[model samples]
Target: MGGRLPMSGMEGFLAGLAHPVIGPDHLLFVLAIGALASTQAGGVWLPVVFVLTGLGGTLLHLAEMNLPLLEIFVSVSLVLAGWLLARRQTPGLAVLLGLGAIAGIFHGYAYAESIIGAESSPLGGYLVGLATIQLGIAVAVCQWCQFLRLSKAGVTEANGSGRSVENLLRYAGFTFFGAGLAFLSGALPSL
Candidate 1:
């Protein structure tokens, strides 16, 4: 599986989309970052670090040096993010950025597994497509969070304001935790 990297632009993009969507942890990670970005400072940099550090991981995979516990790390990060979101904890900017960057490494490593032997051209496209989609998802979610924050949706940070978004986040957090648990127990499958 690791040796069958895509060789075309379309293939690369499809693989990019598949990698994140098929992995519940990956999608939850994006959701966590997006929700955090709108409510926290330097949220904008979270996706950047995720994509870049992930690419670094992909490079490591290509070099044949895998971090032994990458999957466990991914699941752990997902659970922690879910906890933070479930509790409505808005962390400091530095903490958010740092945690997001660390998460990125796990994600990038996973992404790399699919593109192990990709040629330079396809690899470039694969990286761009993956980064672009994930970034776009994060930004779009961030905007949604921002709108909920600013709109007269009859919500406020205090007194259960943003209840809908909060509930969604809570649901997402729970879902992430469940998925992580499932992944850990080998119930659900991942690439």
Candidate 2:
């Protein structure tokens, strides 16, 4: 069953690792976080803020805490994150991290749904998987953006490639924007 707990620690770990990767919305949002962090000072730690708050959110859910219109929050987070990525000028570290914090709560709450009723060992493994994967992805994305030399502004290099990493990132931003809208549309109908 979708709601059933994992039978073992390994299963829980796999499930947690797959959760964000399988969800396009979550995947895009995390990618944007990396892209966003790349342009800011001390930006690499942004994912740490996200992951810590995300763990907090999971704990809240496990405690049976209720967050109203959670899907809406999650969808809106994607929209906000996408908008940040799509913008030519970047915001300061505090602002971006603030957004990441809020988004993390919603995302983590959603993640908690998959691990409900899990044993302590499985739950530990799940948390580790989630943290490791999210952190790794964000760091990798930041490095990739740097490697591509993406400017603070969405500038396309004149290289004959005709497409630049900045353009690709901007395109990704638009994609996330569209995905958020689609998800938001579905979530709103339930309200």
User: lDDT tens string, model 1, 5-78?
Assistant: 78787778777766786776788788777877766755777777777787888777878886777787887877
The TM-score between candidate 1 and the true structure equals 0.84
Largest TM-score belongs to which candidate?
2
The global C-alpha lDDT for each of the candidates, from Candidate 1 onward, is: 0.75, 0.84
Model 2, C-alpha of 88: deviation from truth (Å): 1.1
Runs in model 2 deviating more than 4 A are: 1-3, 150-164
Error of 1 at 45 (Å): 1.5
lDDT (Cα, 0-100) at 15 in candidate 1: 78
lDDT of 1 at 56: 80
TM-score of 2: 0.90
**Against the true structure, whose lDDT is highest?**
2
Question: Alpha-carbon error at 20 in model 2, in Å?
Answer: 0.8
